[model samples]
Target: MEALGDRESWAAVVKEEEEEEEEEEEEGDSANNIGDAIASTDDEDALKRRISAHPLYGKLVEMHLDCLKVSVMGDVAGDLDHHETRYQQQPKDCNKYPQKMLHQSDLDHFMEAYCVALSKLREAMEEPQQKSMAFISSMHSQLQEMSAIPIAHSNAPAHPLPPPTSSSGK
Candidate 1:
């Protein structure tokens, strides 16, 4: 089955298989229509609850890639256009100019920025764990308080009981 018998036979078999799959996917009688599964949900609140309960719902990184560059004047403009002339001018010794491609200051700035981002990610990951630990500690204290209540009651001196009534005359 792995070997193609011939172009005509293979094409015929693939076409037949594709048609079968398309038919299966398009069938309205089946309740497992993936395209309509989420849309057909009757309860919006339940869907939202389920989505929020997802582990990665709020943890995924949201990237901003659509920022627009605005033209600036003065030193800021010079800084923005600093690399334009470099790209326009051809280097004399391109092979020996690796240092020109990247400066030590640039590397240092990159490392600092990377460390900041790494620390931020670590803090984000640890925040939930810290909150859960605090909750557990509070619960532990409450349990201890509850258990101590019973002990305190047990340790209290017993109340004096009234003397038994004298037996009636025979």
Candidate 2:
């Protein structure tokens, strides 16, 4: 038989095998939701539809983060920069809660969306720069076709006039 090993070596290997899969399983409510969600999925499309339809608290989540940011970053910024200095230097009140923005993952999603929009805009702009009216017209036609389906904010019309403010408005 060629099945020989040192006693210490065999013991060490056995010890490692015993110590495998150390992840603590999350028990209770968290596991319940995950199990239920997975069980409910019929197919890929169904899974996607269910996931998107799952009650999204994105705005509420954003508001909560904004509140936390205001308490933390706001205090720090106030000490670092006075109202006058902040306005003079940055001009935007978004500094009050410096991190009142998307989470890293959310920012990644937003950046992807931004790149898509930017590419479309650049493509549109490139048409006229192509030195051919026909190409420009074709690009313009493609944009018009896209605009017809209408994006979210675009579908909603802006108010014809701005509302009168307390201090000033013509």
By TM-score, the best candidate is: 1
> How high a TM-score does candidate 2 get?
0.20
- Candidate 2 displacement at residue 71 in angstroms: 44
| RMSD of each candidate relative to the true structure | 24.4, 26.1
Regions of model 2 farther than 4 Å from truth: 1-90, 98-104, 133-170
lDDT tens digits, residue span 46-158, model 2: 54533333223233233333333333454664654453344346333333432433234564465556556555555665555555767789999999988787445564665
Write down the TM-score for model 1. Answer: 0.29
lDDT tens digits by residue: candidate 1, 1-170: 44656877989999999999988876853656654666567556554543333333222211100010122336664654554444335333433434433344544455456556655665665677679889999999999988877543775666756889888987
Per-model CA lDDT versus the true structure: 0.52, 0.51
Cα distance off (Å), candidate 1, residue 60: 23
